[model samples]
Target: MIDQSLIDLWHGFGVAFQFHNLMWSFFGVLVGNLIGVLPGMGAMSAMSMLLPLTYVMNPVSAILMLAGIFYGSQYGGAIGAILLNLPCHPPHAVTCIDGYPLTKRGKGGTALGITMISSFFAASVGIIVMIFASPLLVQIAFKFGPAELFSIMLVGLIAGGTMSRGAPIKGVSMTVLGLILGMVGTDVNSGVQRFTFGFPDLADNLEIVALALGLFGVAEFLLNVNRMGAVGSNMKLGMKDMRPSRAELKTAFWPMVRGTLMGMLFGAMPGTGPTITTFLSYSVEKKISKNPRSFGTGNIAGVAAPEAASHSKTQVDFIPTMSLGIPGDPVMALILGALLIQGIQPGPQLITEHADIFWGLIASFWIGNILLIILNVPLIGVWVKMLRVPYKYLFPLAMVFICVGVFTTQNSLFRVGEVAVFGILGAILLLLKFPVSPILLGYVLGPMLEENFRRALLISDGSLQVFVATPISATFIGISCLLILLQLLFWLRNLMRARKVRESAGVPT
Candidate 1:
């Protein structure tokens, strides 16, 4: 089986390396990278905008380019996070925790180097997993029904509650707020208008692009506009500084491996895209680190882990979408739509029937990652140079980009207005020491949670026992309960320890 797979893969290389196909792949990644660097723009929007072009192109090359764009944008998102502290994509948002601090300390180049290395390593692993394990992974994914998916999302939300830099309660509060915001728009089940508040523009849910850009990009600009002059003026990086030292590489290596494992685990599961995987990777690193306090203080592992997870998840996300005709996220959904337009059906037979599209795409993953490395690595100096622009000029230009990008998502001015409102809310969260990351996580998973739970109830005729009847659903619920219990124990330990400290200092309780 392995031998035949290798032969087919070699043939796939032939198809992918054809001049026109290669150029399309290059153009896709090039555009994707640019979109990733800009705030408010998302891979879904870029793919959506270019989706029409696929109608006139070869189906094989069309998918190759679109797939390239999807993952290429992921690579570009880290650049914005590392340099400007703007998480152009939610998955890379965790990178800003350490990446921007590295920039402040004149280590932006080293951070970018680590990000590139981790990304390449993780992508390679994910591609290999996709090649060998697609059949088995698809089986596991099939076991997940609405109940199982809902339970797992519950676990994700609980885990997300731990993502904040300040008090866990603050993180939980922000996550709940995100859930509330996610409720804006019409409910799918009843077709009733929700938090839309009589606005026709919000008949659909709030655009995630607007929410993410507002919270991270516009909010950062608002809070820092006064201090922008001194922010990057002292940043000095050269080619020499871009290379990671032995110690830094050593620190990042294990985290990269751990993160890749996490990505591979979650990537094959539909609806759990790179964003949750990245957050989970960051949380795991913080939990296992010898000094967790150093996580937000430019720890190399903090950057390496999440970037690796995001890229790995991005690569493996192709598994279910292509193999089982189930998209892992909205971006994959768009790609699936493109395939349908080409009169191709995706399923188990796709490999035997559409061999060229499947294998050629696998081969293009190698080419696209190589192209991204070439574009991002040698150009680190150029990316870092953007920071040197005076704050007076940069912030306004970024806002313009933000507005334009948000508007492009659906061509609605109302979405741009949504960005402004979230920007003010984000600034308030920052001032109050609330973690904004969880809010995005909650928003991403909230609707999924609601849909799956209601679907499960409907399927079981309002019986709650269906949630635990399946092994997968029950296992996830067990994990969620364990997480909550552990959190309670941790809080108890802290409260008791605080009393001891007070007693030692002879202070009143």
Candidate 2:
């Protein structure tokens, strides 16, 4: 099997290395890189816009190009996250936690450099995993049902609840608020509107693009308007200044490795996309760090781990899609639709039947990663220079991009207005000393949690024991409990410490 796979992969290179296919790959990554730097534009929008062009192209070249755009956007997303605090991609929201802090510290270039390195490293590992272990991983992925999914997502929410830089109560409160906001749309099971009041637009729930851009991008703009400062304005943009020091590199290396492993694992599982892995990766890094307080203060590991996880998970997301005829996320569904348009079916037999398409796509992954590294590494200075643009000029331009991006998501002016509303809300949260990242987390996970939880209950006729009936779900439940317990214990310890200090100073507790 291994030898056969090798021979087929070599033949795939023969197909992917063709002149036309190479051009397609280059064009896709180039365009994707550019789109990624823009606020609100993501790989899905870019690919959807270009999906029509694939109808006239060969299957091999079409998939290669789309695949390139997908991963290439992953590479470019860190730039906006690091340099401008705009999460051009959902996963990049985690990057903003540390990436923007690094930018404020004049290490934006170093953050971008580390981003590229981690991206390539994680993509390489993910490609290898796709090549050799996809079948086994697909089988494992099939074992997870609604009960298992709900339990694991519960774990994610519990862990991710502490993703703020402030007090735990505030973080948890923001997360709960996000969950409530996530419930804005019509109920999926009952078809009853929950929070729309009287608006038709709320029936589909709030757009993730609008929510993310509003909370992070527009809010930052509002808070900083007329403050008269460009990010990293005083930093030197020399090549040496952009490069990470040896110490920084060492600090980031292990996090990249760990994040890649997590990405590969979660990416192979259907329904668990890059967003969960990125947040979980960031949470794990914080949990295990010796200086956890430094996490939101420009920790390189915080940036490296989540970026690596997001990239690797993106690359490995193809496993369940190609092997089980399952689309892990909406973007993968689009790719699957493209394959269907080509009169191709994805399943276990796909590798044996469509060897060229399978292997060529794999080979293109390598080519695409190399192309991204070549295209973006030298452009670190160029991206960082956006910071040098006058704040008055830059914020308005960014707001335009954010508005356009949100509007394009549904061709709705209502979505644009939603951005302004959320922006105002975000500014208020910022003033209240609340963290915004957890809100995104709660919004993303809340619906899924509700859906899966309901599905599990329905399956078990309302018996909650179904949650722990399986080993996988049971294990996750255990982890969630342990996490909650640990959090409570830590809170108690901090309260006692505060009391001791107050007593010593003869002040009120």
Candidate 3:
């Protein structure tokens, strides 16, 4: 099987590793980095903008280029989070805790270097796991029924809430809001409008591209503009102040290893992504540290851990998406959609029938990860210099690209307006300090959750006990309960400690 797969992969490589394919991949990485450095522009938006170009290219090369961008953005997001206090995307949020401090302490080069190195190592691990585990994973996927899928989704929702920063209630509320937003289109079962409100276009429901771009990109631009004067006055780093010391490298090493393992495990699960992996990694590191008090105060481990996890998960997310045809996140879903469009079916037979695609895609991940490391290391100084560019001038150009990109999607002005509306909503959410990552996760998983849930119920004749009766479903729910209970216990312990501290200080409880 391995020998035959390699032979087919080499044939696919003839298409994916061509001069044109290499050029496209390079172009994709460059563009992806730029978008990643800019706050609010994520991989999804970048892919959406570039989707039209797919029409003119071969399917294999198109996917190769898109894959380059996908991983490249993970590399680029670290740059912004380190230099500025701003995160380019949700997964990079943890980077801001330590990355910005490193830059402020004049070690921006060190932070970028460690991130690059860790990303390469973690990505390589993820790819190797993919190569070895794909066959077994495909076999196991055959055992998942509707009840198992529904239970998995339930675990995802609960885990998402528990992993958030604030009250789980707030996180749960945001997820509920996302579910409502997801339900805005025509009812698939009844063929009647659900929340279209008399508009024909809306009957199809909200476009993912429009919602994502508006919420993250447009809203971020507005928020930045409001703080433009303050941002403009900050000093840019000189090249001499950028490099890290051997001590910093030693400090970052273990955290990177821990984060990579954490990310790989979570990323293998369907409906999870780098955003959750990063958060979980950071929280775990903070909990286990000898000097937990220094976590948000320029800890090098803080920067390295999340950066490693974020990029590592990007590679590992393919495990479930490829073998099970169950997306680990929104971007994977889009890739799955692309596969379906090309008449390539996904699931167990996918590896058997499309060995070339599977192996070549795995190979390209290694290539792309190496390229990102090579490209990002030398460009830290260049990225830091971009901070010197005024937002007044920069934002308008971003808006222009956004407008042109949205218009090109469906060649409709209405979509542009939709983007603007979402942008406002995104801006408001940012101001309110509501987490945006869960909302995206919610939107991506909502429809699938509802569909699987109903199917499971129908099969069981509305018996909820079926969820507990299935072994896989029972295991997942059990794990979910344990996680929630553990979180609650931790919270209560923290509260008790706080009260003790207050009492010792002679303050009222």
Name the top lDDT candidate: 2
The Cα local distance difference test for each model comes to 0.88, 0.89, 0.73
CA-only RMSD, every prediction: 1.6, 1.2, 4.8
Candidate 2 C-alpha lDDT tens digits along 1-509: 78877888899899889999999999999988999998778888899899999999999899999988888888888889899999988889899999999999888888988998898899999988888888788888988899999998999899889866778888899899989999999899999999898999989999988898889888988888987767778977876775788999999999999999999989888877688899999999998999999988999999999999988898889988888878877778989999999999999899889988999999999998898888876776788789998779998899888888888878999999999999999999999889998999999999989999999999999999999999999999999999999989999999999999999999975
Task: For candidate 3, write residues 1-509 as lDDT tens digits.
Answer: 67765675567567567787777777878788887776546677788777777877766667777888888888877876777655556677667767766766656667777887788888888876676666664455556777887777676666655444456667677778778888888887778788877777778777665666676666767877855542323544555444557787788889999988877776666666676677667766765788766765678888888888877788878878877788877778877876776677887787779765676677777767767767775676688776566777767866776676566556678778888987898788768867554565566567777888888898999999988997899998897788788778978998999999999999997
Candidate 1 stretches greater than 4 Å from native: 228-230
Q: By the lDDT metric, which is better: model 1 or model 2?
A: 2
Quote the positional error of residue 184 for candidate 2 in Å.
Answer: 1.6
N/CA/C clash count, model 1: 0
Give per-model TM-scores. 0.96, 0.98, 0.75
Q: Judged by TM-score relative to the true structure, which candidate is superior, 1 or 2?
A: 2
- Candidate number with greatest TM-score: 2
Candidate 2 vs. true structure, TM-score: 0.98
